[model samples]
Target: MADDPILRLRGVHTHIGPYHILHGVDLDVPRGGVTMLLGRNGAGKTTTLRTIMGLWRAGQGSVHFDGRDITRLATPAIAQAGIAYVPENMSVFSDLTVAENMRLAARSGAIDEQRLDWVFRMFPALKIFWHQRAGVLSGGQKQMLSVARAIIEPRQLLIVDEPTKGLAPSIIQNMISVFCELKQTAVSILLVEQNFHMARSVGDTVAVMDDGRVVHAGTMADLAGDEALQQRLLGLSLAAHQ
Candidate 1:
């Protein structure tokens, strides 16, 4: 809602059936930069993302995006508001070719050649396997397609979850480069990742979650250099993870 952060969550609480997953999460994804959401397993990081996307309704609090209050908007409406989400599963259509998958993501029903070229530049393998079935592509390629689909259109925000989950070191490095390039673009990013190495590489800012709440919010450089603070918040320093 503010002019700075493209996305803002204040005192957000979410419940999935009987489980209360989030307890007053406060986070901000500043415009035109990458904000890493770091936390341990079951820390409600995924739930927080789902809540923002309207996949899971927040039980209380508010979600604001680009100067609009989107807390009650439906998933389709939320996406229409220029927030693109790539879940942790890398949800590409297995039965469809890479081109087909990309076409589906284009809301206009026609792929933009210029945007396609940009995507191809970031992930060259997508262009190589453009006509191949998505199921036939490797895990890294599928992940690339998923990301390419999200960026096919010009968007204000891109939220990705664990993009480097099963990728090799080389592929992870490629992704790091892609994200670095993305940072220069107009879109801001809210990335939820457990890969601390990738987090340290691409994160400009950070928010650490624990037991469904954001325990720390600060610049990535500060957190990366302070092993003591890292241990207190994350139980291990970035060096340990490295």
Candidate 2:
């Protein structure tokens, strides 16, 4: 692993039954920054994030966090090792109040109060809706709660999948700001996003995945400077955002 690379995956091959999804996926999430994973739907972006989180076993290859091999670790063990995963759906407890959900995520006193304070500061909306059931909150609110839960404990790495999906543009902007702030902390972020404009806004480094392989990677500036590369890989043009 490279020095200070918080998360790294090398030639990872993960298969679900007879269907192989991740084929030689290589990725790196550096410390104290956000690395965006961009791809078209069915490009295995979510699956790659899942594999990194150890939600499923990788048939071949190694996953490293803080310079330790974690490929064979169980999902709960991976989580206990200071990696947190916030899925595309923002998995909130629908039946539980916002406060209840947060308390439950603390893992019976394993979480840090200072971390919770930071998350609440980042998302004052969550503090405001503390008594409401997660099911009753709006989509953007749920996203905030999901993020809050992830930060309930002081984690070294954070993985977020499609966090902007179904959110209003205003909410997306707020989320982008939160990500920017999170990058200032020690926690590294690996994000899977189909939203190009948002990805461009927050991605320090980018890896474009297609057909379960990382086809392109570099600094965000590299991706932004090449219009042809952007158009070809993502079917996106910055003109559309203007």
Q: Per-residue lDDT for 189 in model 1?
A: 94
TM-score of each: 0.97, 0.94
Model 2 quality (TM-score): 0.94
Against the unseen true structure, what C-alpha lDDT does each candidate score? 0.94, 0.87
Q: Clashing pairs in model 2? A: none
Model 1 agreement with the true structure over 1-242: per-residue lDDT tens digits: 22478889999999999999999999988888899999889999999999999999999999999989999999999999999999999899999999999999999979999989989999999999989999999999999999999999999999999999999989999999999999999999999988898899999999999999999999999999999999999888899766
| Best candidate according to TM-score | 1
Candidate 1: regions farther than 4 A off: 1-3
**Per-prediction backbone clash count:** 0, 0
Ten contiguous residues minimizing lDDT sum, candidate 1: 1-10
